[model samples]
Target chain A: MKKILLSFFVALAGFAAHAQETTLAPDQNPRYAESRDRYIKAQDQLLVNMNTTVQQTYKAYDWYEAKQERKLQRYNDRRERRLLRAQYGNFYSPYDNNYYSPYRYAPGFRRNGWRRGW
Target chain B: MKSIFLYATAAILLVTTACSRKVTRIDPVDTPDISGKWNNTDSRLTAEELTSQILTEKWIGDYVQAKGKKPVVIVGMVTNKSHEHIEAETFMKDLERSFITSSKIGLVQSGKKREELRAEKADQQTNASVSTMKKFGLENGADFILQGSINSIVDAYKRKKTVTYQVNLELTNIETNEVVWIGEKKIAKNVKN
Candidate 1:
């Protein structure tokens, strides 16, 4: 009877060792797999969010810069015209005006109309 | 006829001289504010304000204590909602330069620059030798972001005017979305014509 009891205890120890050796995969727990997938998705979403935020920030500044450039160009053109007007008497000045003037192209005057005082 | 020719030649010379643009190359530091607009001098002043106010803020100390490392910073958009045309990029560049020169915090590139960096890294993965290639997921993410706005108020009566430019810059904690610091620099110019 003692031999039979000893054999039974040995068999129980062997069974426990086999069970310990056969470890369950982590995915065996549905919650564990679900949590891992959720974490990965969250990380991916975070990256997208960061990318979008920076891009939008840059886009806003780009628009502002372009607008400022256009404004500056307009101001510079206007200022140049004003300075030209101030330097060369008026729009009727020979060097300043591009419009057709009856006095400039009168009957007796040639190319140098201002010089001959036509 | 001789008298008329001489007068006409003199007038032509004067007009030509007046119309020709003469640009003198002077030191940028010595540039004068002739337009009464936002200029490099104002940008320099803004840099001074940033160094004095933003760097010395209590938030820096608090971040250092909590993180035990220098906080990383990234500069974001600076909107120009002003009366005159203001190039915010130049101002932002000045601010970034100030931050870098101070060495109080770490600065990282944002926007297209950052994308370019990532693309280089991605290219390295396939093209570079295994031993020499750089790995991903090692970027130093910014802890704080700085944003600002340039606002101006102009009061003009006839040819006399006072243009006041108020630059408001704020730094915020990226993770917590809490405003860590706010700095303002106001420059006012009075022009009489």
Candidate 2:
């Protein structure tokens, strides 16, 4: 009887050790669960709205950048056409001893990575 | 007569077009985010985070248990180490307003304001009544100084840039020089050109 009782106690202890309890459970209260579900749905809707907004903003910004790039390209092309004379836009203005270019400083000199010609 | 009429029409057109600016008033609490830089929204959010986190920290409870009174805190320097010129003063002002009104911690005068207070008290010593004049030694010394830094990291590829700001604040005990509490608020912004 003592051996049986000791074996029963040992088996109980082993079972207790191996059978770990879990504390993860959804709220049982109806009010709490309702609020949680509402909060989750609202959060999901907010994320959807945010993603839509971010995508739109990114697209708009990209369009604006493309517009600016096109404007810059047009300006450069116009300047190139104006500069590419018979002398490859190397024509010096008679008013000053400077090339007829909008770029500051001499074409042979580089100032802040800006030069009409090198 | 024709030349005068042409000039008048041109003048009226120019004036009307020049003054065609449309102004729309917005709620200060909720405004549209433009340029995605640090603004009043960020300041308000940081202040809100600070109020909630500081009040719920273990240090507050510990201090209350030890002293039976709320700890006095003085707002100090908050350095802005960002790529953009972010004004930390606005954030500090928001925090100060929250701290004073929260009733969680006793707030004290700090920086130039404290110096000006002292100067006023000195002036009052000679000009004002004894009871009305504020005394210098009677002021509440701060138990902790709240200081922090606004640091940012920006990653740019072509026209899009992601700016991440880490605002770190620490409360240190004046006597022990031990950091009793630390709080951080991270705000990330994705800006595209």
Q: Which candidate ranks first by lDDT, i.e. highest? A: 1
Per-prediction interface RMSD in Å: 9.8, 14.9
Q: How many backbone clashes does candidate 1 have?
A: 0
**CAPRI tier for the interface of model 1:** incorrect
The reply for model 2, stretches above 4 Å from the true place, is A1-118, B1-14
lDDT of each: 0.74, 0.72
TM-score of 2: 0.60
Return the lDDT, model 2, position A8.
100
TM-score of each: 0.58, 0.60
Where does the lowest 10-residue lDDT sum fall in candidate 2 chain B? B83-92
Cα RMSD (angstroms) for every candidate in the order listed? 13.9, 21.6
